[model samples]
Target: MRRQAATFVWRAALAAALVCGIGLLPWLTRTDPALTVLKARSADRDPTPEVLADIRAQLGLGDGPLRLLGQWLGGLWRGDAGRSWISGDEVTPAVLQALGASLLLMAVALVVAVVTAGLVCARTLRLGAHRRLDGRRTAGSGSAVLAALPEFLTASVLATVVGVQLGWLPALGWYGPQWTVLPALALGLPAGAVIGRLLDDLLPGAFAEPWALAAAARGLPGRSIARQAVRRCLPGLLPNLGLFVVGLTGGSVAVEQIFDIPGLGRTTLQAALAQDLPVLQAGTLLLVLLAAVAAGLAALATRRIAGPALRDGALSSLHRPQPPTRGIPTFVHGGLLTLVIALGLPRDPLALDTTRRLQPPSWTQPFGTDALGRDMLARVAHGALDTLLLALAIGIVALVAGALLGLVARVSGPLVDTVNAVPPVLAALLVTSVAGSGAATPALAVGVVAWAPLAAHTSALLRQERAALHVTATRGLGAGRWYLLRRELLPAVLPPVTRHALLRLPGIALALASLAFLGLGAQPPSPEWGLLLAENQPYAERAPWAVLAPAAVLALLGALAVSAAGGIRRARPRTSATLAERPSLTRELVETG
Candidate 1:
């Protein structure tokens, strides 16, 4: 165990370092002098011959990319970010400010995710016999949809419906807690869905173990069984927890830009747009670093949890247990969706003062005015409806498409595995970037990417369930193919499938939000979180904090997702009892002999 722990730690550390290195590339990257000169000339900001010579002398611009990268790496080791390209400002302070905001946002998001997910999982497990379905039934579907989305979708929807049309809150300002709602919800949905699905899928397996069966026979009941099983299954699961934190925060970049949240993602996007190399590099580095830490912790936890397959948390409670509700799924999911719409709406859905154009956020205007003099608040309010509608469409697109493709691939075996293993998000983004455009297209594009994983996971799960003892028993009883599939197969599969479907909401929302932020989803004069950030990018330096509020909201939403994922993971182990049953199997065989 000690040896395994050490090895896992080392490997995890290396993997985390690689993630950091990828993040550091932007900072350590050197601008090609030739390209810089050409770019500068095209912009009519060409440096004279003297300036070129001076730049070469000062920064060795003529050096190879490797050397420049190496030198930058050395400087970074000493904790220094070089000078700024545009304003000649020290990159340290600016980067620190952005990093601080980002860290704060990520931390806050984490809290939201843990609390929500944990409570949900604990409650679900505690509910015992009254359960309708394990959230895992839809896990594949939900994960596909959420993973396929970008950040901009949530931002746009919430900004329009909640911030503008309904006028319940300020769409643009970051003044206090009131502004944090929309973005947090946006980020949380998909993440939570995925987590919930994973837990649901895994938990049942634990419950079916001989010991769990014995506990159940003793009338321990379903809810107690669920909690006990989850407690025991942690050892085999937590290691799979990767840098979702990174994904969430990275998604936050666009999310922040849209809501004008004052997080690192917002600042970094501004840096990228302005070509502020130092700020961009630093901001990216911070994100990477945060992700790396999350990864390491996941790895460490995985290693520790593997021992005894979680015997500590496996103590079965001997108390009387209550029977659960039949078929009434927790409407907390509905509440989440409703809240998303609410955040998108404005209190004054009809109060539009369209007299001013491009007015800044203030007490009077609240969310302020847009470039076309439309009330930002109003635009944001309506945007909520659009955002939610689009996200729903996107979720449907990804879920159905991915399910189809994933199922096909699963039946195809190796071919499906290979294709699914590819970097799906990048591929989809590339396809969209190359061959697609507009709102629905991008959403579908992301959904397409998310499809393979959903298919693969669903296929694996269905295959396992189909091969379980119950299915074989049905077959022995001469059940027809259709009946076997409909009654036994479908029922077994539903929990995972449903959980997957529900969890996809938040991640897809984020993906949509990102597309909008990148100018892919929503276009100008439209009140959306992403477009809002893009509009504010030019003036980011003037009022950096303006963007912080919305960005934080997005981050918080993402955090909620992470929390849900954690909760789902805690719900149950997918292959529960396998390890725990090994010893029992040996004993049974010995006894038979």
Candidate 2:
């Protein structure tokens, strides 16, 4: 117990160090904040050296990064977060207010997701294995499709159908429960779909377990057996709830913006745009802390609820050897689509024709023309190539790096845990500071952030596979490490890795879009979807098509990726008896730590 306490203390210290390091990212990356503020406030006149020095001294920029970090930490310790540059208000109060609103939004969304998932699971449990499989496939496909839609698009559709068309709720505002209904549903629906699929997969193997069988042998009703199966699946399901929380929090940026909610997400977005360092840092820190705390609590709950037998059983099931199955159709389609777009699209996306600006969709230009009169079809097609290239780069880099690191992590567990604790947004911001604004920069930033999750997943899977009976037997029989890994572990790891990569593509695309929207990715006239949204936002009232075109394409791409991943997961043949019962160690670790 003492040793464990010491280890926990060390881990906490390391985590604190990581957070402090992240807080200095803005300072390290940019020109001094004083200079940026001076430039923003006084753009017309260049400040003399004396003037610049005065501003720097005023803002405490005279101190080095370490000192600045120390001061910030000191302030945090004293329950103060300083002031917001944009609003000149006390940062803590504003942050607390925004956090409260966001928490409310997240809580409502989570409840919706859980209720929906429960209903879906309850209905699906009544079916036979084949029928259940079919139901899962159908549900998974639908979920993937819905999950592909970005928050803005989902909010828009919900607002239009439920609010505008039906008048069941108001289209905007955040006053009453009726107002919360649209945003909550927008956030909850996709998450519910994901949870439902997870429950679907786990229920079959759970029903087949010894206890479930014994209960059935005692002539327990089907409903009772189903309830028992669900209870058994809870430990695995609990970890994903943490992820859903993080996703909803991150996704709230776009939803809050669309709905005009004064939440932390919107405040963070505003800070990022205005380069308000204090608010941005504080907001980011708040999010990272929330995710960490939530994950830790979920992990503790799971560990407490799951007995040694269940934990051991679940862990053992994860390592069971199985024949690998390939799902090649999605890859082929993706590659072909990318190739066609890259080759068939116009050479230049920036060519502007002023006379034809803001034209709506027609036979002549299927996607319409933007305010610059750039052919929307050409721009979107070219943008698709850019988006696809970014996703591909992120996917390849993250997968390869993650797999290699996963191997290392198996031996150096503590190091991996420390690294994984660093928030992805913080990492991205750090990368962005050094790399600057460009397609490559955001791609690299996203790839760097993405690698942690993939690495964790890969490491956990590899560790389990290495401990399998076949691997132990082969090693005892004088099989070399290379031979064992090549013949055994790689096959076991590849299928899930492939599926994970597919699922990650949509996320990468969304990240790219978000960064680009913030002007940190694929700079002006790039025709990237996010850039398009940012550029045309002001003109949205006049030419709504400018925003809709890129949004629709982005939505379509996301849907495609999600659908492909779901189909592959569904179609892959199950070779192990405990196939669906395996718990994801990476997921638990990511959420918990």
**Number of the top-ranking candidate, with TM-score as the measure:** 2
Q: Score every model by TM-score.
A: 0.51, 0.77
Q: How many backbone clashes does candidate 1 have?
A: 105
lDDT of 1 by residue, 415-492 (tens): 232232222233233344345555555566456544544554455444445545545544554566666655554545
Clashing residue pairs found in predicted model 2: none
Q: By summed lDDT, which 10 consecutive residues of candidate 2 come out lowest?
A: 570-579
Quickly count the clashes in candidate 2. 0
Reference-based lDDT, residue 586, model 1: 35
Alpha-carbon lDDT, every model? 0.51, 0.64
Instruction: State each candidate's clash count.
Output: 105, 0
Identify the runs in model 1 with alpha carbons over 4 angstroms from their true place. 1-59, 114-150, 160-179, 214-225, 233-241, 272-277, 310-513, 520-593
Report model 2's TM-score to 2 decimal places. 0.77
Best by lDDT: 2
Cα lDDT over the full model 1: 0.51
